[model samples]
Target: MPVQATSVRAPFDMPGILVPDFRHSRRFQITEFGARPGDKQSTSIAIARAIRAANAAGSGSVIVPAGIWLSGKIHLESNVNLHLARGAILRFSDDPQDYLPPVQTSWEGIECFNYSPLIYAFDCENVAITGPGRIEPVLDRWKIWSARPKLHMDALVALYDMAYRNVPVADRQMAIGQNNLRPHLIQFNRCRNVLVEDISIRGSPFWTLHPLLCRDVTIRRVSIQAHGHNNDGVDPEMSQNVLIEDCVFDQGDDAVSVKSGRDMDAWRLATPCRNVVVRNCRVLNGHQLMAVGSELSGGIENIWVDDCHFVGDGRGGDDHAVPINNLLYVKTNERRGGYVRNVHMSRVTATTLAGSVLAVETDVLYQWRTLLPTYVRRLTAIERLRVSDVHVQQAQSVAVIKGERDLPIQDVRLSRVRVERVSGTPTIVENARDVTLPAAVGRNGASALGADFKNSRRI
Candidate 1:
């Protein structure tokens, strides 16, 4: 019973992208289902009942009034909108058992059966979680899971082996072994016509908002402040025709990370993440404004980011300044066999950055280098990256490109990029072709790119 709401065309350059509109949906209040404030079990049961009722009614909104409601895992049904009223605070419990009966989910790009995300929607259509309120976690227990001990690494290796062996997804389960794999805060898996709007998310155990294998998704006017490990604000993986706009992110990882999937599993699916638009967002703290991969074995293309900027002194949870590392970072390795192309970024501004404006590395394996031997060696092809009108007050460098010798990165273009002060080299290039930048070096011996430079050369 998916909602037959108006499917408004997305306001982006991508074709065939539609956003769900649930303006006239009926309301099913949780209070009417015997939900009480501060009672986790009651609220959880009541929410389930309300969702069931709403789904049975064809299309409806399960509303939470202005109160602090403690809940467990809240699963959404098709056509059901989980709406939180203005003063509502929907707080989730951190007890891992609450997310029991492991659902089909992925951890860090590989598919496995893990603890359910705090809010999960699977194979549903026209689902949403809208709020002018707040959603946070009772993160006492989850905090302990954040530190990746040896057990966690062992579990990841196990999952990698499973994927490498092409094991059936249903047989690859990680929830049974006290694996301590942190569950995502919210995930929409294999769903379509998704909309998440006007929500303020405070903390997350893992990635905050994830759209996996979804279509026609719109995330608008969302604010996130999650400072835990791997707390990437939004991860669009294997998704198409996505729009992320009017958002604010202060996170421990990248603000907006576009991923496809990991190695063998992704190659099997053969789905690429494409046609994504990120605009009019502000980053307070993050590793990168947008990171294309480290897990992109399924390929990524047609990404456009514009009118986004870094703001607010880039502070972290300890009240100390946490410098944003880079504006655009694309990372892959010899083990990843995919293609990255047609990425365009423009009209971005920042006060200070800890790393370069553009960074592309082909040898970033992170902890996986020693965790396990390379099961397979396949090179990734990265090309056609364009950056323009980026003005940063101070940064370490302008560009850093490290590509493989045989298949180097190709067609990198930067124009109207102004850096007030640079602490290091203007550009460092190796194994790349067709890199175009401004001709004039800065007064401080640093390089600032502008429109006047048009020559392209291999490095």
Candidate 2:
């Protein structure tokens, strides 16, 4: 059973909830700075100054008055509150360069190449971004990133080199087109005790909002979407305690993804993103409703995902046709060894394309570098996971659990899992060990010789 915020925790059960408590805090409005409503530049400057002032003022909020305040990347300070007035808009500028050079941030748990997000916070304690307003990004930020010719091999090489080298992300010249490649609109790294509530965010170039490597965070009653490449909503990575409740996601990719890190940096961190609960959220136009790791470096444990409606576009096409590719996706990009444990998901309903309910994959980039034990040990594996009382409809297989020989998944159980396929049967399990299921869940799809374990499962 899921652990309640007010209840005690059991050994095998999820830990108690971790919703942030923001009942007490001082508020500072942006209007006092004399910036007119809808003038993005002046208002942004004022907000930045206000954040600094609030920090200097000893823990108070910097409120955004009811209007549009256009901006680029704005750094957040500790103990500062960013409150949005009831009808205000905190719009992000579209020019990619406005985001500036790349910052050292966690992308799936490891330091990587990408632009800083529109609203960012790190190393802050007891923070909150609350409002009943909108955060709309200027799409032009992505336009610059997409202008690069895709066939340019030289450009590709340069990018790969950047991602490879532990490059200092400061004061570097970046290709504008590449920023569009990143989907993070709002991101927080290494923060503690934060609350994000009652905001409507939209139009992302990359992942919508990422809360990476943070602890004790809460996101409630918010509507956020960015229907573009990898525009995932609320990726809580490598963090300890998290609660994401009563939110709605209409995105291009996964709605909510839990991650640690990626490859070596993630394994080295060894920080399992654990004790998470995502309940009563609504997902629309997302491929995976709730996901875990295409890049899980540290690992994930003790999670609960329940009572979510996953709806799709019935008009039928790859774009909007999928409510879920994965209701629960364990995508292990572990270049280092790690373990995923104690996950419980219940009452998740989905409308789908050709995908799975539960996907356990290990595409560890398993090359020669991945063969060594210490190197191979960094690979990701799933242990002791359970899914019960799931009702999946609108035609697809029931579930798929698979892995590689280097990192085989074990001790998986599924009870009362039902599937209604529109075109064909959806149950497929390959290369998994000790897998258990309720009688008569999915009744289609050919069984692999357990050889599909070695089959590739990459994004």
Candidate 3:
């Protein structure tokens, strides 16, 4: 059985040094791992053991000295600081099984087996990993697929006897079925007062940093380069009071994505991802610069994106290196019956090679997804969303914003959005109507298609 976590919000759900919340205190040091820079022991084992020990002692810091420490699948605890000093590297081993015994985690809201990430922290409070060093993987590009694969129980059982002599079979069994996270580089689930600053993360196996159900978290001055699959920079799921600023992402997937739970796990953990502010960041060569949904089952509210840049190298062409509906994409698939509210975006600039802007797509047919289509019982809504001062040049297509046929893109407003491309004219509102546009931006210089409106007005 999965470990049941109670849903009672602590007196303060948002925890961190900057906010008020309840959490533990723990400290540790990782010097015992016999690995050095080029020849070091598995830092994963050493760090995991350190977190376990820090919880045993009082709350404090888990110090990583300056050197190359090799490791994999490091789990974090509440009330501890995983600190790496200058000139330190927490390198991961490429052995697939070394990241075994999966834990419950998500990707695009689908629970599946993948390796536990290098630095994993779940359901924590007042936790931090602050340092000025690189947390990287020893593997080269294109070797990531072999390094992480889904968890197989039969394989776990076969390797269980010798590899896991001390760990109980029940924990192992539970782990095998849980959402395998290559353990998110750092996951703070339902945590508060989380701070990750002044760290450099490159050459990661998957998504670099993930914070789920957390509050009052801050990520600053972090340089990330995970040029591989599912390598999003930071995924803040159902969180609140988050600030991700002064960061750079050159990744293979979306740079930053906001999410809710997926399926039953998502509905059960019905937390709202709200009050997030990301500014002064550069998004280079990713699927989406900043995305929300496909997995927004829980809810998304009160999000703000400002002063971010998405630059493309003209490779995607009409295919689009940065593709989406609205520079801010809001989509709901088969399992989407959640509410998206109060999203305000401003001063966002993009140099898209292709794709649309103000995209509001819905898969009401719901035929393509893995899960059964949820009945559209309640009203499907994306209310009170606004975009302003967006300028895109040289896009293959114009912007299009549309909602599902039954629920259409309702209560969305756009102002001063300019799309300019060489060959293809940027279209707006493919099957969308009742959406508002500024008086100056009323379908200027493009041929619109598939736009069916009931009653719409220009601001």
Candidate 4:
């Protein structure tokens, strides 16, 4: 089934979410800073010089003209815009040594000082990465780090232990020998008024666009096709007042994964990710069209997704032949103490789904059970989710909601959903309350419950 164009609007007026304006900023060209195209020499020094000059000028743009530019890291400062004109290709170096001297970054929601992201901004405001060009990383060096060797797993365990023990973030350095924790492609840490638009991202070492502890961020008209391990298209962690619209994602993981921190660390941070809106997006292939994570211990609320189209067949052939796992997936585990509430999605259409159209589960800690000890067991409260006007052509199931017996998901409503074919059970509800589906859901050989929906009420 193909997705049709629909007019869907945001549920409420969000005054805080606005795009950054860099129209009158001055321009600082990289070519003037001794950066030459097609030269095998490293352009890291020149690019850094351009950024430094732009930052010193108080408000300006660091321009990379139409050419193939090679660099190591491109760090941004407040009031500086990194603009890539047409035909500009910014390629990153493959050597790990080029990104030496660990910077303050987060690896899987744990704060640590690791290699800097390819494009990083720390504690900056009014920054942007405007582009009509391409940004790609040399994947030969990063592909090796994707493997989870014993050393990598051990480092993850240690990181978790430190978080459980309340160790300072500065003391948790993860750039040890052969640790292999990859940095993200673009990370804006503790920044405000950020904008990224019109860019085509080819490869990513980790999460493609990570806005950590940021506010008033806007990402629009961007195309991302990164298929590495754990390469989620965009990870909005501990951020607020954000808008992500009109983007194309063909990812190896979730297209848009909303997270905060994890466990004790998140509990201490105490910043819930809230007031975010995503609309007019297209997902070609991904594990989930939209996911609210396994890393949300700091709470997540007020999320709105509207007017999105997902086209995939779970196979690898043409544009409509690829397969998306789930249309909407909300995952949390026993260790997370967050609350997910007030999420509304409307006017979503999908072609084919490999899994359920909607999946809400607790106890989804696939590998953390054996890797680290659960410091605190907290039951997450999930409530007030509404999905409306959704059409799925083919799927394994229409909905699968698995909540804990003690803390059941409450007040979930699905209306105007039209599913052409469901191979498996139509809906499976376990430990939930007030889950109201359309009356025509289970007609025509669709099993509403899987044999395990016990204690579910009002379905």
Candidate 5:
């Protein structure tokens, strides 16, 4: 039977999120199904068999014992928990053929049929991946696949065109050719009451962990270290009532990126990503601590970030750290018609920042500008952003807001934010309204703002 774990309370005032608890569940060992260490094919087959056994027996855990086991794609079933014992290392196959037969997955923000994620769950309930083992991809093949040549760009163009025309999703397949749209490390698509806890994940082909269109997710005490291109630590896309806490993220991109769908597909779905809380997390290196959309056309609301910090020296050491950039970034373009509201951040600290503390840009389409013409001119409405009790030792700038003339960003407030030193201008504003940076929040506890800026021009 599927379990609906009770909602867990959050420190904030929002609704509690549900998480699966599988304490007394029956355990099905993979070794019993003839799994052998270091054999990818056998281990993969054994894992599938064990999952079937566990699911058929009501609810149970499919246990992977301590060893170096190699496997292919793992498709989670309903009412099943895939647990790994201590000292267990599950390495995934590097060959592309292991992920054949395209699955319903998304790339960036566009939905299409692509290679299955290394671990995937579609339309399942009460699923969890727990325990203190390591799950990683072999980077040998993925490192080369990361580069997007003309073939990949052409595939992206086709995907965008399909979305624009409202083509059936079943017909849009990109896994047939050398498109090279890499799959995510783990994806739980349309699954409810999901829990991912105590696992260490390293080396991703794309975005590391994604919870898409799911409800009531709890990700706790996990560690991620993936420096590959587009390797965001966690992306909660079009999901609701999520709580991510007590995690350590050393990422190539943002630590937590909250996104909705993109453009036309988003408009059709009209499901906003809302009610997400990220707390008590640490970032070693990333583009930003948190980023909200260049893909937010379905709208986003009610996000809270609390007690997060950036650690590690900016100098790239033997660990190949990339250094932290901005504390928070909200990016969008004219082609996306969405709204971002009620975003709050508090108790954040950083040793050094390569960019501004907060940045909002209205024009942030990387390659889409020239690749495709804007079929529709739609703007994103961003408002009601608050930051408080943030202290940074050094930064390039305090804040930067660049909004379009027609639809400017509004109602941004900063309080008790102290930066010891800045290399560039303390604040830069363009086409924004009601930006209140109080005199109390500044460099060395001095006034950085002379007065409240309303409908300000570029400075």
Candidate 6:
């Protein structure tokens, strides 16, 4: 049974965040454009025709009714809504040649001309992808691209150099011959007033749902179960006024990772991911329920996660039992110069957490340590992080907050947090200031009043 979440309140007024409505819109059917069900023929041209007809009709829906439609890529236009009826399945082709003529897309926060995402929209307004249907990408070819050979690493290094040297985005073309850079499943780039609701997504080539530099986005009642490499469920990068609610994430990486581009590219963009809210969500399995960076260089602020459930021990039989790495994780390194502040999480319930309930580390350089040379070392400023009313059934540690000696984390508070079983240290604090844990509990059925602190003061 799924755990029921309590009522959640948004931290700030979400004025412009509302679901887009298409009640009286006209419908352009894909079948009318010669699309057949279950045929091995590519439906790319047919779907594209249908979208063009819808767009030409002035704000309408391109309907895909109850069938398995195989396609290569889908490019959405302005004032158009792609709607799938119940039992509709849109399967994408796995061949790399299908998504040709690289469009304006990004590879891990660095802007480049790469292969288009499976469903892509660029600089459009009032666009949506809504349905009670499934969008699956056949990854037989993409899975091979997952291997990061020296060629891939060299390409990455080139991108980093170009970013630091302030190269024009048009000059950074990554889709050369035999260069395997995976594309996102769905990406809305520089779009406004986007809505994705009631959709089921599976088998992504890369990050599942990515909204880059978008504004006023709402993703509600969606289900994503993609476990491919680098398949983060939802990545809102450099986006603003976003809301993700009542979604289920069974991912291979962080469920909801809020990023603002990466180092030099991010500094160049100068757009912080701000005013995002995630509520009433369920994490069946993921690396973390919510993660705030390893790539945040443009800063992240005013994030709220409330009334969520993270079932780390899986939701099915024995094969499904994978413990979550952490419940709430904030990770940044010295090379990432950003500010993380005003983050609040409340009424979260979890079970079988492999790490601490809350873990914040500053020097978490996963592959960048050996991958690229640090161009500028700017320490992040993390402050005013608060977690409240959280209950964890089991965890390795209650909390671990590690900050840099030169730049300490400040004003962190954990209140009304309880853990049933803790097998490791209850709390570990270092290089912080004004840290307070009023109701932090552990396996001993007592408050964490005796935990040791290192280089921290004003508890």
Best lDDT goes to which candidate?
A: 1
| Candidate 3 residue 232 C-alpha distance from true site, Å | 1.6
> TM-scores of the models, in the given order?
0.95, 0.84, 0.77, 0.94, 0.96, 0.95
lDDT per residue for candidate 4 within 305-358, as digits (tens), equals 899988655652234233587778899988898999888888999987888768
Off by over 4 Å in 4: 1-9, 39-42, 315-322, 442-452
Who wins the TM-score comparison? 5
Model 6 lDDT per residue over 1-459, tens place: 011122325776545574456777888888888888876353677889988887887778889899888888899998889998999999998887778789999988899999989899999888899999899889888899998888888888888888889999999999886668999999999998898989999779999999999988889999998877898889999998888999998887789999998888999899999989999999988888899997899999989999999864654222433458777899999988988999889999998888977899999987678987777999999999989999998888878999999999999999989999888778889999999875557656445666768999746
**Model 3 per-residue lDDT tens digits across residues 230-311:** 6778888888878888888776677888887553445656777877777788876676667787678788877777778776
lDDT, candidates in the order shown: 0.88, 0.68, 0.62, 0.84, 0.87, 0.86
Residue 345, model 4: Cα distance from true site in angstroms: 1.1
**Cα RMSDs of all predictions?**
2.9, 5.4, 7.8, 4.5, 2.2, 3.9
- Model 6 — which ten-residue stretch has the worst lDDT? 1-10
Give model 6's TM-score versus the native structure. Answer: 0.95
Candidate 1 error regions (>4 Å): 1-13, 317-321, 441-443, 448-456
Which consecutive 10 residues in model 2 have the weakest lDDT in total? 450-459
Provide the lowest-lDDT 10-residue window in model 3: 1-10
lDDT, candidate 4, at 3: 14
Question: Can you write out model 5's per-residue Cα lDDT over 230-296, one digit (the tens) per residue?
Answer: 9899999999989899999888888999999999988988889999999999988788899999889
Predicted structure 2, TM vs. truth: 0.84
